[model samples]
Target: MSEGFGAKVPADVERPDRVLAGLTARQVAILAATAATVYGQWWVIGRVVPLIVFAVLAGPLVVAGIALAVGRRDGVAVFDLARAALAFRMRARRLHTRPPGTGPAAPGWARERAHYSRYPCGRTGQLRLPPHAITDTPHHPAPLACLDLGTSGVAVIAAASTVNFSMRTDTEQYALIGCFARLLHAQTGPVQILIRTHQIDLRPALAELADSLGRLPHPTLRAAATAHHRWLSELATDTTLLTHQVLLVLREPTHLHTTQPGFTGAVGSGRRVAAVTRLAQRLDDARRTLAGAEITLTPLSPEQAHAVLATCADPTRDPTHGWTHSWEHTP
Candidate 1:
């Protein structure tokens, strides 16, 4: 129901106590470390020590074991796994934090600010990207999308659109296949394509629609839907179906082409739109071909597109939309 610091909440409910419990997460880590060190050292030394010396070591071992037991009840139970996950998140740059509170907050930053009183959110107690630092770029990549262009040069990842092949004509499908091959060849360099598949749980959307339907003077559609659902449920007992949503990402080289020189006075805004549209059209055409081949092509949303471009983009010169598929010089 709410998103904060790159985290998602399936429900709007909040348990400040649950978050504060994480404060003890660090303790599990410390306890494990302490146990390993103390017990390990004792065992190592006891191997060579006399019976009396070993007995002495056993005393400390007993104390350490008791401490571990207390630590577990005190909230260090998931310490190892949680700490490792946190470390991985930091390395992947996916770390986020949330503060404590009950009221609804702003989407990201303001929401984070709202939760500040509850728990320390964000890794290292800092936001991943500063508010002003989030910028608009040419090919907006998803916030979660990352691009790595080495020998392949360019990589663009965004949410994509999916088309069902079962709906297309034979000729259209063949044309689509050819178009897809051409699109792949058109890549300026090695391209890494990643498709992220998720589920579309339209329950919330349908529920909202239901409220509007309820207000309708006519109950025809609502009644029909209810009947349909009832019949479907009766027909298929205990059946669960998965709805798959797809995101398409294309990674290639960043290339620059000849353009009119000088800033502001060079190309008019109309020309820029035309050019972007033209490129989009070509890409869309190719996407249709890929669709025939059962490949889903989803362009990144504006913000996500910008993020992807920003990650691999060079600031020296503006990259045209087409440049998303071309290679650029790496300094």
Candidate 2:
């Protein structure tokens, strides 16, 4: 960055510029709107009430306006925080997963008394889901682990290997950073790096050890292996082992290479072909670029990508490791 933008460049380029009296445009607007609202309120209610009473009513409004204008929580404006809070409060808390046109309803006998301040769905036990989690219904030409996020775009995900940055020397670190920078600069479309951490699973390792127990050549070797396995089991019981996965997400808009705008929206065969080609090319470029920094990229199969999304949507319902879905072939 120093080579391109000189020694220093402002990091918070997205931060709104202060327009008047140390207030951003949003803050200024909010304050002005509040002032207008308070003046209108006084025009209607001030004459009916005493001076002290009117001040009492307007004091909270003034304080709220000032707080909205100047206050920030965790670097987010107070007004935004309040809006988000309102949205959160309004959204359904319990969500049910079921096929379409299967939402349960109150019985005919209890229909009159059923509709009130909600408790719980007596039959199905949750409200309808917000939207379809994945629409594999849409024809996708790419056989890779990519999703057709209709209208939004197509996204391809690759699991990325990590490098031991702390172990590298200063010279190696600088070179690695350069490689990383090159990868970032080379991106023509959106590239997202997602890091997810989960509890390490040791069941498969233990099962493998058990299977190998009888195949050992000597009793001494078998006994040693048994002891090591036992020790590992004990260690696992005592410690919480953690593992993290790094995923590189590459996106290609449907309309990028397609001529007809409606074709992109429909995600026709040609549009799908274009999206797939672009995504594959980008993924290949990223793999080669990241390899310079000692990072390997492994493209995920469609099943694995879907599993990852399902896990993300409802983490508590399934374990992250060794995810298996009904869509996968039994074999």
Candidate 3:
């Protein structure tokens, strides 16, 4: 792991068998170095206590007391504060969870005798000690695959693809229709097709406009309402109105570009802001490409959308048919 957020995600969660099998050579070296340092410190403190006392016999005992308290209490407090800070920053971030039902080992696992064993050489009387390997030879079983082990058991989300029936050539469409019919006829799985219709709400805008008119003189308000109604009536009858059908293709992970324009240059900076900016630019480019193909692209903002659609029934402009309309709404 290359520092930064790498420490947040444990490579092996309590599954010591995986820890043994999966650790890199460098990681093993670091683990050994850390263990050696801790044990070496303990050994020095144990055997050299008398010598240290003799060397610092006149040294103030007060400083030693403060050092001990800081090492034990303040050091622990600092460690805990660092942990809390990391946790707070991580809560909103999306993390890949480990396979279900894995947790860290119990306390003092490395200190346990089961974690290490001494071996005797066959050729000589020399003794060699090794860290106990977490193997499935006799003690452990195959770890469980990561799955959602909720009360509802494991669940997986899959999205079904949508089909366009109106765009293809007649011959190709007919062939596809026949193939789909045959497939549906022969299929055995329980399949469901859902169709959802979203309707635009213009009541809020209408009410706002009405309230503005209500604050005017009674006669003026009445006249303005009549004019508005007449204008909408004329537009419905005299203008060609076509439904601007928008098909949003959310490219998802499949169509997204893996490399950004400046990502290579900024990779080492590790700024999430840069990655997000790249994604935004890519999304804008994708939408522009779609719009160039005559697809009406809508934004994800509902308020902005409402403001844009507020003029849907306006007299001078018709958004349907991309400024060219052949069929007008009849009321």
Best-fitting candidate, scored by lDDT: 2
lDDT head-to-head 2 vs 3, winner = 2
- The stretch of ten residues in a row with the least summed lDDT in candidate 1 is 128-137
Candidate 3, pairs of clashing residues: 99-146
> Which regions of candidate 1 deviate over 4 angstroms?
1-135, 138-154, 158-173, 225-241, 252-298, 302-331
Worst 10 residues of 3 by lDDT: 129-138
Model 2 vs. true fold: TM: 0.68
Candidate 1 similarity to native, TM-score: 0.33
> lDDT by residue for model 1 over 1-331, one digit each (tens)?
1132143555534322322335444445555676677677767886688878766766776566445434443333443445577777776343223333423545897756756757545333322221111112245232222232222222334445555555777766556557656877765434455543222234555556556656656678778866665555554444543444344444333232323221122434344333333444444565675665666666554354453444344433332332332322221
How should the candidates be ordered by lDDT, best one leading?
2, 1, 3
lDDT of each: 0.46, 0.72, 0.36
Better of 2 and 3 by TM-score: 2
Q: lDDT for model 1, on a 0 to 1 scale?
A: 0.46
TM-scores of all models?
Answer: 0.33, 0.68, 0.22
| lDDT at 179, model 2 | 97
